[model samples]
Target: MITLISSDKRKFHVLEEVANQSLTIRDVIEDRRGRRRADRIILVTNINSKIPEKVIVYWLRHFLMPEEIAHASMSHKKAEKLKKWEAKFFDTDIDTLNDLILAADSLDIPSLFDGACEKVSDILKNRSAEEVGEISKIENEFTHEEEEEEIPSENAWVWRNEFA
Candidate 1:
């Protein structure tokens, strides 16, 4: 068993196999092999307690089906079920999704990172430039004149939704 300590000082106990879904955790476990039992405690300083809970749940779900089976010979119904579960899991507020992306990246969980990024893209899709900026909290740094004239004039072929 491995104990993951969250940034908020919460501890999550998980089987080593389940936690191995994270390459970072797997590597840590490998490196500490034959060491004292205390070495099994991993401090996830970058992720908050809530994120660890979510991550553990994700790990447990994925752990149920081995990767070889999931990638090669899983039944169609099982695949569909897993897809639906992933869609629902990622259907969350933008801030939480962003945090999950960060945590997944830091933990080297590629599937989680990609799923969260896809959801974020879906949320941003079909939105106007201003709406996208507002949703992403990006400030418009360009002056009104620069935005309306200079940039468009410099790149005349570039598509401008607002101007269209």
Candidate 2:
């Protein structure tokens, strides 16, 4: 078992395999393994307690199975179930989703990072640039002339139809 210390000093006890999903945590564990300490504690300084808590939840949900079982093809039923779970996992408020993305990236958990990115992409798809800017809290700095110059006459129809 490994004890993860959150930025606010919250402690989470998790299985080694589950924590290993985080490459950063795995490296810390590896470096400390030589000491032969019965209990291992790793401090996550980059994220706060709430973010780490959510990350731990994700890690537990995606706990790795045995190598053979993991490599074996999953049945359609299992695949669908996992898909549903992923959808639900990403069904969070925008702020939380952003925090999760940052946490996943910092922890080097590729799947979690990819999932968060895909969720953000799904939200952005089919939306106008203004809508995207609003959702992401970014101010549009392009002037009218710049916008007009950026869209060529040939593609103006396409752009108009897309944003219409």
Candidate 3:
């Protein structure tokens, strides 16, 4: 088993094949898995727990058996289940979603990047400006005078249950 050290110092045990799904891991494993004392320890020192957990779990599934997702001849029920699982995995809050996107890009996981980006976009779509700001936790930069001058009086209470 390969030892993976996530950015947050969390250690994980995974088969080399699974860990190899990460480009960074794959490069290290390719150089070491065949060596007499090939280092099995991979240190990822710029991420957090949630990202590594997500990566480790996804690679474990996709690396050794990508054919499952690529197989077009599978029974409909099995494919449907996989689809449902993927949908659920992609459904994340804005904070986790943003972190996952950054992690995916750093680790060179294209599918994960696109999947999370799509979800983030979905969350942003059809949202009011204030809702977007609130969802993303973005503080308004307007000063007191600026806020007073630019406040939309007509939609001042747009913060109500209009979207509820």
Candidate 4:
């Protein structure tokens, strides 16, 4: 078992495999130095006390118990199920995604950071300026002149083509 300490000093018990998804945790394990506990005491200063709590709790609940996850060599069916479960593990709302990005970035969890950033980028892409603002929860502060300036040309919107 591994202990993960939050910015607010909350501690969570998690499995090593699950917590090692964060590169920060991996480094702690890899370090020959005496600071091995550094991995267990993660200082996610940027994330609020909520997201890490949820993520850590989820890992504990889902993967901590030995009976919860069996090795893939034992059964193909179990392995497939585990794969599917992990695939949807990070699914969340936009605000939660942003929080994940903040937490992951602060923790130096590259995979989580990349995943959250890619999700945000995908959400912003293939969307008009108004749609992007709406998804980001930004009020449409652009004046009429700004709106006019946003559209490159009337034909661009009217035509179908992928620009990059």
Best prediction by TM-score: 1
Comparing 1 with 3 on lDDT, the higher-scoring candidate is: 1
Looking at model 2, residue 57 earns an lDDT score of 80
Off by over 4 Å in 2: 36-39, 64-71, 151-164
| Alpha carbon lDDT at 13, candidate 2 | 86
Off by over 4 Å in 3: 36-38, 63-72, 139-164
Among all candidates shown, the one with the greatest lDDT = 1
TM-score of the candidate numbered 1?
Answer: 0.90
Candidate lDDT values, in order: 0.91, 0.79, 0.75, 0.67
**What does the lDDT read for residue 81 in candidate 4?**
70
Candidate 4 error regions (>4 Å): 15-18, 35-40, 57-83, 86-88, 121-128, 139-146, 154-164
Cα error of candidate 3 at position 74, Å = 4.0
lDDT by residue for model 4 over 1-164, one digit each (tens)?
Answer: 56766667776776668876666776776673455544355555545677877667544544543432454243777667755664576566789888888777766766557767887887788998778888898887667866676554644677767778
Count the clashes in each prediction.
Answer: 0, 0, 0, 0
lDDT of 2: 0.79
User: On residues 1-164, what C-alpha lDDT tens digit does candidate 2 reach at each position?
Assistant: 88878878888888888889989878978888866655487777856788778887888777743324434786767667777988998988777889888878877898899999999889889988889898988787877876778656546776575443
Per-residue CA lDDT of model 1 for 1-164, tens digit only, reads: 99989988999999999989989989999998999988899888966898999998999999998778889999999999999999999988899999999989988998999999999999999999899999999788999999999988998766755753
> 3 or 4, which is superior by lDDT?
3
**Which residue pairs come into collision in candidate 2?**
none
Better TM-score candidate (1, 4):
1
